[model samples]
Target: MTRDRFSYLAPWWLPGGNAQTIWAARAARRHFGPAPRWQRSRWDTPDGDFIDVDEALHASAPQAPLLVLFHGLEGSSASQYAVAFADFAAAHGLAYAVPHFRGCSGEINHAPRAYHSGDFSEIDWILRRFAHENPSRPLLAVGVSLGGNALMRWAGEMEQSATQLVCAIAAVSSPLDLAAGGYAIGRGFNRVVYTRMFMGTMVPKALQKLEQHPGLFKREALLAARDLYEFDNLFTAPLHGFRDTVDYWTRASAKPVLHRIRVPALALNARNDPFVPAASLPTLQDAGPSVTLWQPAHGGHVGFPVSHGPFGLPGHVRAMPEAVGNWLLAQL
Candidate 1:
């Protein structure tokens, strides 16, 4: 409910919501820049699959605060936002690592199942292991889009149990209401552009998975899927043990569980976000005492383009990561 958490002003040239969101995903990669160096580690999951993590650290600060980053759907450590965040963490002397969701690490996973919006077990395993390995360092987390939804769900499920594991959490442009999000992205321009973009990669991946595990999925229905809703109903829901797309979206959404989150958490959603409708965003009252919902008038999806200086000197200033890093630093 408090509107004074952080101030974000979009760039002068980037005007509407679509422009800001599209440009960030399309044109802003080269401008925002990349991480200095990354150390890759693969962790084998108990379910016989693997999640790859790319770590970016300040060599001088061995015990600096650690941040566990979760990238969005179909996104990996190489994503523009992820790389930008890694750069920010490294420059600030914060040790950070991005854990790629199943089958998103540029390598095909072993299992037939892929990660969904609400799935958090893989992230939990990574965090628990990180906390165990580096007990001295402060732990914080940031999740983007789908990853953000999962982080919120995990925080809610863990409640006070997360206090020792993470000092605080931030969710940027998350689709907290999965049903609304799914419906929003299924219509008009979103269906033609965003849905196709997602399904383009997803269908092929599902086909590849089918090739490895014959007779495991309904190939005809999956191949016929034109949008996210159809894809979920045909593939994601069944593969994840949900009865249907409606059932999956209802249960997987982070909105229902936001009240249960016990950690100091920030959920930042752009009012103009193309994918997640502004109406779907949780209110401060719905989020309970521990969580804060900040809906800026601008900032499309994960895109928060600002003037320079925030991310060192001039050029493209990614506001979300800078805001998150500043908040985490304050919490620490």
Candidate 2:
């Protein structure tokens, strides 16, 4: 694994980790830039649920490279990062697709089962389908946050087999160790703010699913849950067939399987990311030969805010996606 491959420089205004992370999502308006026109495709899963993919095509290339994106938890194709990447792909004449996780595609899934950190079946299916359907175009993939974890896990699980399908893979702000990440997000302000934000959407969705499918979820227990750990313990674990939260986290964490990844892969994490601790990251020695770990000092989760260049001239604001797109382009 290479150590000097990635170096991130943040904007002068955004100093700390929290500032960079929060500002990108809350304060920065232009970060999303102009929205791209997308064509929606519905894919039917084997379990009867459906996954929605929003595709943005290149202007004139039948065999242009394709980039498949996986969004973070509770995020959809409309997410700022996803849109930024879609726009980047379009501008660079590359085809892009953002796959929405189960129950996140603006329509509630039919089955009670939804996506989790370790649920790699959907992504695997999507990659295989794309490879089969678009044999002429080279394929690349990127994932953010929870989606990143799942992508890395899937790549590692596939090992040497993944090189046949994907040319390269990149993951941003992935919680490699689920337990540490869960604990980090459950403490102090992160618990009060981020955890609440996550639960605000998660609890309602779980309740809605329960309402749709009676006897599938324990309403009382789910209602009482206030954080991710509790929610996962009550719903995510049991629904996914894990014995408990610890078991789920242990088996789902990508850290253990990272060394098994054989395809050219990059894992980017910020040292001060609120959702994941630095301890969760793998050292260069521990990483697979094909994997590169980019631990920037101040990216703050998936946020890598760049300045508008010297003299405050207008420049690219989406640093993370731009960097990722550049890296993937180089790989191709």
Candidate 3:
């Protein structure tokens, strides 16, 4: 497994984790190029639910590789990272698709179940379908945060079989240790900031889910939820077959399954990521040889802004996607 600083430096102006993360989410939008004109397609799930996929299809060369991006929690294809990667794919002559997690798309899903950190079955279904559709093209995947963990779980779960579906996988800023990350996000600044922001959308959507499926969960308990733990216990866990938050976090974590991955996998995280405790990250010995641990000293929570962009303002953050994309291609 590869480790150490592998070419990402946070701009000197933005040194802390929150600064990089917050800027990446908020301000980096202005720096990105025009958003791609997406070719949207809806695919019905096996459970009669649906997911929307935004595709930026361009083959600079015949059968150029396709990069599939999985967005973070409460995120969609319109996320800054997704746009950045889309811009990168266009510039480099590759096909890119961002498959929205059920409910992350504009519409609410039909199922009682929603996406979770260890939703590997969802990943398996999506990627395999992509591979089946484009048999001649190589498949590459990059997952951010929650998406990353889930993607990693699918890779480990599939083991050698995963290699047949994708050329390589890069998981950016994944909370591999769900228990640690979940716990961390429930406390102090993270709880006040991130947890609150997430709940703003999550609670309402969950309520909508409850409306769709009567008695899916307790409305009072869901409303009382002040953190992810409580919300997960009330909704995510029960709907997805987990006993509770603890059970869900324990069983869904990708860290335990890392040793099973057979294809080239990159687990990239910032030591200072607020949501993922640095101590929770796996050691070199903990994973299979196919895994590469790129724990850069900086680059907070998928935020890898350079000192300047071509526009010459600070907080240019596409470097993360580009570096990972190049790394994935190198494996081929």
Indicate which candidate wins on TM-score.
Answer: 3
The collision pairs in model 2 are none
* lDDT by residue for model 2 (198-232), tens: 99998888988898889987789888988899999
Please write out the lDDT profile of model 1 over residues 1-332, one tens digit for every residue. Answer: 25436677777778878878887776674223344577889998888888888887445376788888899989988777887787778667788888888889888888989899988776688789989987889999999999999999999888899887999999988999999989999899898889989998999999988998998778887888888888888888988989999999999888988899888898989898998998888986788788877888888878876655655223354567888788877877
Candidate 3 segments whose C-alpha is farther than 4 A from its true place: 29-33, 57-59, 309-312
The ten-residue window of minimal lDDT in model 2 covers 26-35
In terms of lDDT, the poorest run of 10 residues in model 1 is 308-317
What ranges in model 2 sit over 4 Å off?
29-34, 57-60, 309-317
CA displacement after TM-score superposition, residue 200 of candidate 2 (Å): 0.7
Backbone atom clashes (below 3 Å) for every candidate: 0, 0, 0
Greater lDDT among 1 and 3 belongs to 3
Error of 1 at 187 (Å): 1.0
Error of 3 at 289 (Å): 0.4
Score candidate 2 by lDDT: 0.84
- In candidate 1, stretches whose alpha carbon ends up further than 4 angstroms from where it belongs are 29-34, 308-315
Report the lDDT tens digits of candidate 3 across residue range 1-332.
77974777777778799888998888764225556878899999988889999888544565889899999999987788888888888888888899999999989989888899999999999998999888878999999999999999999999999998999999999999999999999999999999999999999999999899998878998899999999999899989999999999999999999999999999999999998999999898788999999888887887877756555455667788878889899988
**Residue 61 C-alpha lDDT in model 1:** 71
